[model samples]
Target: MLFRMRFIPLFFILLSVAAPQVVAHPHSFIDMKMSLSAKQNKYSSINYEWKMDPMTSADIAYELKGLKPDDPRWKQQEAIIMANVLMQDYFTDFYYQGKKVSFKRIPDSYHLEKDGFSLIFFFTASFIQPLPIANSHVEIQTYDPSFYVSMTYPNIQQITLPSEIAANCNVSLQEANITDSMRAYAFSLDKNDTVDEDLALGKQFAQRVDIQCP
Candidate 1:
């Protein structure tokens, strides 16, 4: 059974202190890295690593204080975090040949660790149906729809592919095109403010990963 959602409090608490007065939409940041794995010419699973910024990490650490790895509370905390991401579809938009793709959660793959002052979340999810990659195009975008948190891959090298398909596939990163109006809009919102969910403010600033295999 999935754990009850307890991450909201943590999220809101972090956001409350993430920015002062002038900061824009993204109050917290997560550095992301992903690896794509394949089998029998079909893309199968994606492994994700998200490194929380120091401020966010500190908040999380305080919440998890004195909890040992073997503590049941540790697992509960992990489940809560995983559920938070699952509620958002893992913050991923995947497409194959222009059609949206779905994913299945791999609960056993969820884990967390500390990296210096940062906290890193690690998880894996498989496509509901593996997507064929031979002579096909695939696109993946990850972002926080609410724009409260900024998720980004620091560089193109952060994304990796299975070696067997690496040579056959051409990959590129498309940076988000943030317009002046968009910047202004983000700037106007304070930490307590929220953008309409329908607006998908974060998607406007999402970086896209495009892949083609010939």
Candidate 2:
């Protein structure tokens, strides 16, 4: 559910951190397909395909509605989106054995295009250390903390597992566990301010995938 109703003004506010803040609420909805692939039996990368809801796309396109596809406006918008996401670690989190996995590479080159009325973003977040098959259990989640944008995984069956590994691997999706106190605190922020990361309000509401290789 979208917490806030105002769209255009809120969109611009989120684009610029320096802009006047409002209580953070979702103005955009994203359907995501994420895949985990391995190279030589080690986890290599996490790829993302995000499809923005048509309404959100139209909201973002409001200014450049008539611009040519080759216009600099499109490029500028794409750059802005990339910069924002990069600054936020691509809205992704990964863990192995309860420790966070640091992403070593976030490529500058990404695919952005207008798919019918919606906008699509595709990219991969790579890690410096490949997760060994012996790791056995790993978890990955993606979300935007402030709730300015809500991200949902379209299907758990779409997630890929390491094929070359000897053990049987299974993938499962779990709903985020948001507590009453955390929920109350999250809504209290105004001007786009977010609760402390320790509360994990967004993560608690995000779609999480648990990988087990036995």
Candidate 3:
């Protein structure tokens, strides 16, 4: 069975005929890379790059095969995907001094490409107003609230900071510490199952990027 979601389509490649009860915690996976840039010590924008897993990429490619770039259907699909991302706030939550920060998506910055068997998505978001970084505490987390998709940064090296504030700002990646019980609960859910909205299961599994400038 195949299931489609906001960002990546979920492909059940490992479905078993004999033991059909087994389920996967996350239907799809995304490897994410991010970079933050500043303009004169003020936070300017964040650039995002996401690489979909091979199986999911293959499924997506097959689904959209034979459609040329100029095809109206192809363009429509891209628009739908972007609209979904916008509804989810681009899967990013940025906070400064405990207050949520506002950003505007750069429409032209959104694009997709293929890298080997993987599909890559690129986008940029600029702050509504360039935020001053001095003596500030910023927390950034990227995640899918539903927990249907798993997003991760393979390493801290995948996150970049601008040279202007690299010296004054200290950055760290804090991985999620999900308990054993939560893990079991997540595994118990089937692809068709939906958790309560307030649960926000994905947030519990998200890695936080903390930036402190002094």
Candidate 4:
């Protein structure tokens, strides 16, 4: 009996070690909106708002439930969440005249609120140097490259530009194309699998806001 008990524990440990990794999927959905404001014909900042689905909100709450905002643990958890998101470049991209624009730093302050059953995140990512909108073409896209979290802009009207720039620019929405090969490859991905090295994969799957000025 003693030998059998020891062997049983060892067997369970080995089984656990040999078990496959749990691949993550899109368990969270977000409805997103973006806005751009200009000052003196230069782009001032880009603002973003996101509303997470109830399931995702509930899952997130489960970990920090019962902890007040003032609690150290609560603050720590919030910091960790922000850090991870920032590490992903806030899941945003911008293009100017066919060249990519990179952010110099992440937003230092943001707002989080619980609205009914959903959790909302609001923040603004500022430009390192204001982009002049005069006679220039620009495009913006927001997406998760890993495909583990699905993001969508439900309303085309959610994208807004300042009144002055609106007159000089034309704005349109471009739907992302998911090719057959990409779809099949994405479907075949498992937990331990990494996405293709093609950095443009996110842009291919991301809805783009195209703006042209003359």
Candidate 5:
């Protein structure tokens, strides 16, 4: 029941000068990976799983025009628009050995510090579609715990964004806004029990996380 917060403005659109509009939300990640184990001589790693919605070009147009889907501007930008829409699915629930591990996100304003696994959300120029990483985001690590943390398995594989799922494949363009959302979470298999064991470990992970989006 605990998750981390995120508000690191991964991308910047400057929707409008007078209004200073921005279209990026805090929950936008399309690519993901899982963790596996290798100590057993098998090629496997363990990582929490998460899914997101496919970004729609229509959404980007609306954000840029500062209007709803039916707005006239949407029609104008419809044909000449590029987008990097993302949606969420699930999160890592538990680890194998009951070590109790988890992750979360929080929201905040534009602020990014240089870190090892910083994913810079950049905005790309597509003829009709928008790439999600064109601007300047500060985070993107394929590893479950990212470069900041070491992997626990011997077959730890480095995950990354697949090309086929990219936005600038069929279209001809360069650059894009690279932004991401905040995810706050923790670990503990207390939920799988028969409702008799007290899940205190999960709460411990929550206690370790503090709001850093503000």
Candidate 6:
């Protein structure tokens, strides 16, 4: 049964002290890896990278839709998102776990493509994170700096905290769990950081999420 839309921690995204602001997205989990290649006019093939085995792929297939509250696919998304939040909170409570975060590394890159105004997050793990990619629909508070919205290829946009979100980035998936389902992430502007470090965190988070799906 569809319960009351309890977006308690879903709508507002409270960044760390470095990014002292909260925002929302019309689409959940906008940031994800995917691979895609068109074969003439046929349906272009797409897949998620985290699908290391067979079981996860079967489960993630439906939850990534981020459909309506009562839509048949809503429950699936909810379960996956819920599981992600639990995992994140668990690891985030203290500090770093074993391998930095908790995601597993895979050999394949996720196959993805553009769809209308969303950046579709497809993976071999059996599920896809339906993202609106054409136009930017994200918002950043004034206190936050360094923020960028990408309308191009994957790993294209890099938004910094304290940086105002463009008028284009004004979307937060009203249908999906913003905190758990969002592809967007937060980080500091320290030069000491590396892309792979962030990638590791993202991978761990994604891995945690992939395991949550029923």
- Cα deviation of 45 in candidate 6 (Å)? 36
Residue pairs of candidate 3 with colliding backbone atoms: none
Give the alpha carbon lDDT tens digit for every residue of 1-214 in model 1.
Answer: 1122265622243443454663666778899999998989899998899998877777667666788767787778788888888877888999999999989865439987878778899999899998888989989999888777788999999999999989879999999989898878987777678687777888998999999998
User: Per-residue lDDT for 16 in model 5?
Assistant: 26
Which candidate wins on TM-score? 1
| Lowest lDDT block of 10, candidate 4 | 2-11
lDDT of all predictions = 0.80, 0.68, 0.76, 0.67, 0.23, 0.26
Worst 10 residues of 2 by lDDT: 1-10
3 versus 6: better TM-score goes to: 3
Predicted candidate 4 versus true structure: per-residue lDDT over 46-147, tens digit per residue: 888888776556645555567777777656655555555576777888988898887657673666666777767777777888888888898888877766
Pairs with backbone N, CA or C atoms under 3 Å apart (clashes), candidate 2: 21-191, 22-191, 22-192, 23-191
Model 4, which residues run further than 4 Å from truth? 1-25, 64-77
Better of 2 and 3 by TM-score: 3
- In terms of lDDT, the poorest run of 10 residues in model 6 is 142-151
Candidate 3, residues 1-214: lDDT per residue as tens digits?
Answer: 2122344323232222223554656767889999987888888899999888776567556656787767776666566566667777788899989999988854436776778777787888888888888898999999888777788999988998898778777889999999998888888888768776787898898999999999
Instruction: Return whichever of 5 and 6 wins on lDDT.
Output: 6
lDDT of 6 at 18: 20
Q: Alpha-carbon error at 66 in model 5, in Å?
A: 8.8
Off by over 4 Å in 6: 1-59, 62-69, 90-156, 164-214
**Comparison by lDDT, 1 against 5, better one:** 1
Candidate number with greatest lDDT: 1
Residue 23 error, candidate 3, Å: 1.9
Q: Residues 1-214, candidate 6, lDDT per residue (tens digit)?
A: 0111343222222222222232321112234333322233211223332111122122333333455556645554544434433333311211111122222222123332224333233332211222222331221111101121111113322221111222323322112122642344433323222234333333223221110000
TM-score-superior candidate, 5 or 6 = 6
Q: Which stretches of candidate 1 lie above 4 Å from their native place? A: 1-5, 9-13, 16-19, 105-108
lDDT against true structure, model 2: 0.68
